[model samples]
Target chain A: MQNTSLSQANPTSEDTSKPRKARGPKWWIDFLVDLAGIYLFVVRFFKDLFRPPYEFKEVLNQCYIIGYKTLPLIAFTAYIGGIVFTRQSRPSLESFGAVSWLPSLVGVGIIRSLGPLIAGLIGAGKIASNIGAELGSMKVTEQIDAMEVSGTNPFTFLVITRVLACSLMLPILVIFTDILALLGGFTNVYFGEGVSFSLYFSQAFSTIEMEDIFASTLKSVLFGFSIGIIGCYKGFTSKKGTVGVGKAANSSVVMSMFMVFVIDLFTLQIMTFIRNILYS
Target chain B: MADTKSNFIKPLFDYEGRSRVVEIEGLNKSFGDNHVLKNISMELYEGENLVVLGRSGTGKSVLIKCIVGLLTPDSGKLEVFGQQIPGMKSYQMDAIRKKIGFSFQLSALYDSMTVRQNIEFPLKRNVHGLTQAEINQRVEEALDNVGLLYAIDLMPVELSGGMKKRVGIARTLILNPEIMLYDEPTSGLDPITAGEINELILQVQEQYHTSAIIITHDITCARMTGNRINFMYEGEFVLKGTFEELSHIDDYRIKPFFEYNEF
Candidate 1:
């Protein structure tokens, strides 16, 4: 009994005093634990999603937050990217005496790859980090536990709504980004080469195949889902105290950005494979 | 020696005739290599306040958390309302959770929501058929009970520490739970505010006829709110008695808790 009380009084000593066998590397153990946690989280999300009493109001509110609130930033980045890419490529095209291809060049670059990638990275930085911080603070404050005790499913109310909103809205944001980029490109072209609006748009749309639009939209949707899930998972598993919130937010952004790149790589490979099969 | 000591203490504080709302026998819980709870046993009867007095990190909070299904015991029996909590499914635990209100140490009010919204949240989720008017009435009544009716429209961030505790209590009481679990309910408050909270706890227990397991080190709170007191040390109840009975005991292990000079 005295030994038990002494052990309880100083837990660190008890832990260190015992000689225990190694259980693999610490990092590998942590990775496995994190992977299992994410798996459980995904399973819980789907379970709640298929169950009755869907949270439509919460989903719409999240859409308004994750989509409508993010338009300005997306528009700004797209516009800047379009102008810069057009300006940089114009000189080379002129040197090759193929300045007429400038519009199509910028269009394909912006629509097929740059637009979705940029939007996803932006969402990862903004929405993913924001959700992570928000939910991390909730966890620290026990608000999530309060929700659970109140008979409100925190997984459904917090995780599902945010995940669904991001997945559904990122594609829309990417489309909007593409449109803004094209408009910026057209503006630059009209001024630089004295091309008419009709001519510039025609050149741009001429090279944009149906496959390009489909693939880009698909990438955005997947990126959105990854960002949302990673953020929620990080925040949900955050440790106690204020520092945990900061760590959650930072890790969420980092992981989401990493996932975006990975997803983009696989998507491009899949798209190239399909194109080859169809046109070979 | 330990067995004989516990046997000598156990019969002196027996609560046999009353209906037990929560019962635990030989419960154990551990975190990594640290055993937080070991061979713990207690019973919370209907409409009684069981104050668990313990030093920091003595597993008092873990004990109540186990009762409320937040933390699973490593082994042994833990039954609440005759249902074993450890083996219960998520939905089943949630069903049981509706009857148990846990007031967290930090109040745990949703910062994004106003007090009215926080109070209304449980009613809207738990009581499906309640109309807006009925929900509003209940929210107001809960707020009124806590004497914070005016703070209803204000957000949790705008609330003071004492006010947040009151709002937490109001939110917990809104559902009229059969069991209330208060984890350090008055830990960080001023003495006056802590007294008010303790009084409010007693009032709620009496008014709602709910059994409560309040985990705290506050002697004033223990004296005011507890119908019976259980002093926990090293994950086991060292002594169980009324405040007056336990305070008068000459055991050195229990002496510091009653000694007023330290505070």
Candidate 2:
């Protein structure tokens, strides 16, 4: 054993060499690779969801964190948004002698588009960054690796639970945002025009169709998925060190928001196309 | 390279009358033109501590990671308990992983969990059908083994460096693994703390009768824990012997490590 061959072993003589820079591929190539990685992540998540020992406890914990913890901030922002929009629209409607339309207009806008979009963006910023940073730190510290070597599936415990929580919770949070925003709108309309609460709500409900509610709820679901998946992907693939954690958190927020807009655009187009087919 | 197929037929413990738990042959790992491990080969037998001593970046940690199937080698034959690691699927690797415990350099305790929770994590996951009482009993036993029973309820953030390492070892020992892979187990501790860790490692090995691969630069740790020492330089094993045998070696690459007087 002492005569173990060293013919192929070339000893490193000096330690003066600079650490190699991690040269990334071109932007387009990087984008394609990231897209592929996210696609695979989604595929793996679906594959693992049906497997045994579902992480129900972790899922509930995440829902508490992602949904319950986010209510105050989401509600506060949505309420302010509703008041600001109503105030901005009041003068224009009053000039056009369409003040009576205030309840219907704001109600339709809040229920159909503004509510889900704003709530989705808020969830993306709050929940996405939270998940990213938490998991990035775990990766950096080898907690994730420890979990794996201990025969626990980190993907099932960490990624699937978080993604499901965000996807399920975001829609519920958006409903809450829509209701709060309408209340805020009602308050503004009452002060501005002395509209009775009964009359204002009647007008509000009269203009919001089943299709509008359905479309917005569906959009929120997609937004939630994008936010959860993007956040998990960024974190799971984080490189070594604290800088990697920061990057993961930053990019999770940015990418989730970007995907929100992209999903919004596609959902609107698809809704319009379906409506056209039905009417035609 | 010399008829390793015959090794498969040989009884699991028949490598010179000692059972081989981990076998590596012609292992090569490279990171984008920078060769980290070059045709490395070694064997870890049962009931013995195998220490690999090397500089910080000489692939010691990488070798252990590969053994645990965390890092896929470029090309090599890595068999942990007769299972080919590089080609094994996730579930297969997971099955093998259950029998092996890896204690990371930083202890890698979960910051969100208390010491008790961290130790119970593996037990709850791997050993099914255990009641909570049984789990708690095992957690206590593991912590007691590492002399950290008093720190059970404390979170990882509250523990000092040596305390964290003890907790980490306790967490790994909870599974009662057959093979242990330790990555720089005493790299950042003070001298006294480092000596304590080394003694704890020795006690654990003797008590559990498990084979281990400890990668470290600490001479005291190497001397205290290793039954055989492999001196790695530039991703290759430059020498292999006992501490006393290697101290007298004339090779300059292997001389600096033994020259240090500090314990």
Candidate 3:
């Protein structure tokens, strides 16, 4: 009796995303449910990961989109990061009359942390939000259900492919960021101190080892995975209507960025643990 | 009130002889504390368009979604082809889903793909063992059936609202589903466009011999497409009969629905 018009094709019959006023006892329940939901989502991802007539074409397409389409931004940001870091550090090094150490310092910084973090943060914002919004739109429009009814396992085709693309492409993007950043550092140092390109690179790389590169690559892969999974989860579970799509996109960006930093902290500890065992 | 409750609507035509392809008894669904569906029971007879008419928020869409296993019911005896749908795993449901074609209200076409790609989707995934040429031929035929063969190359965004619905039908028909679930087929459409869609629904029921459960509030569509009608309110059927039987009901619950179509 409240209204007479139809719901205009919204799934779930009613708008389930409408806020409930009282949350006194519901807070803990909500938190636990969300956590459990994420856990099951991850489980589904892994379960579908191994058993599949793999969506190779979609995976490749996602790689090209995630990697190739994102190259310009990654490259530009890393180059700027290298320039700014070098510009700021030059004066400090010069005051101590130890400017000779600048190249080595720049190399370590870029390879060990800066490149991976930049790639992850940018991927979280760009890639994860896109995944969230795209899938969220699909969810609201019932494209995911359509896929299911059409006999395509949506988790396998959509979720697995995007996540795999992210993992595969992140390492590659991190490498590009690392190389661009160094080239940017070289440009700055070469102009400021008149250092030759070859000599600058040689000094820069002198202090870096295989461990630094391996750690950075690991972080990149983990960042990619986190970005993909969080985005997919938000999108796949989005309810209500177009409003839910917007929320999904916004939360995906925030959560994936948070996850990127979390992975960074853990990876740093992991790297230290390995170093102690290896170097000892 | 007691007299009216005792006089609940019944079928004027004998559909008991028809085999029920979809059967529901005391079906219930809830989202948190909001119980959307409550003790609902219905049956979709083979090759008949069973329209469940209800205003927004009456759990009409939820019912169809439950039928197709897209949404699980909280408690119910919901079945398609007499197989219980609620507890069936997704893969197991896929076998059943191949026989059900669900044409979404918004068409739900893959926007990134062309119309031809959308039509080919169910065929490429569900109806395996077909060659590329066979797929192409079938896609063309499906499009031809919907009178949109020229739009095969166009993206979903480029097509008009009616065209999108037609393409959606083409896609589902490519699978030749035994049961078609049309969720608000004419909800957001103009009367003329809605009439075309209603005609298409009837044509599908005739040509493909599909048993359809059309969830709509459009009385015109309900009249045109439905073999029998059930008017739902607050998660339960308030009235149900053939259009002939329902149009004459003087009850307040049923008056507004048939009032518009009255001569």
The order of the candidates by TM-score, greatest first, is 2, 1, 3
- Find the candidate with the highest DockQ and give its number: 1
Docking class of 1: acceptable
| lDDT string, candidate 3, A1-280, tens digits | 1111111111234433344578476767955876788789889888889986688999999999999999999999999999988888899999999998999999998899888998999899999999999999999998999998877899988999999999999999999999999988999999988999889999999999999888998999999998999999989988889999998999899989999999999999999999999989
Which residue pairs of candidate 1 clash?
Answer: none
Fraction of true inter-chain Cα contacts (below 8 Å) kept per model? 0.27, 0.30, 0.27
- The TM-score obtained for chain B by all candidates, in the order given, is 0.93, 0.93, 0.94
lDDT, candidate 1, A1-280, per-residue tens: 1111101122122322233566777877877887788788878888788886688988999999999999999999989888888999999999999999999998899999889988999999999999999999999888998898777889888999999999999999999999888888887998998999889888888999999988998899999998999899999989868899999999899989999999999899999999999999
By DockQ thresholds, what CAPRI class is model 2?
A: acceptable
Every candidate's DockQ is: 0.36, 0.35, 0.36
lDDT of 3: 0.87
The lDDT for every candidate, in the order shown, is: 0.86, 0.87, 0.87
Candidate 2 lDDT by residue in tens digits, A1-280: 2122222133454433356887878989967888999999999999999997688988999999999999999999999888888888889989999989999999988988889988999998999999999999999999999999999999998999999999899999999999888888988988988889999889988988777888898899899898999999999999879999999999999999999999989889988998899789
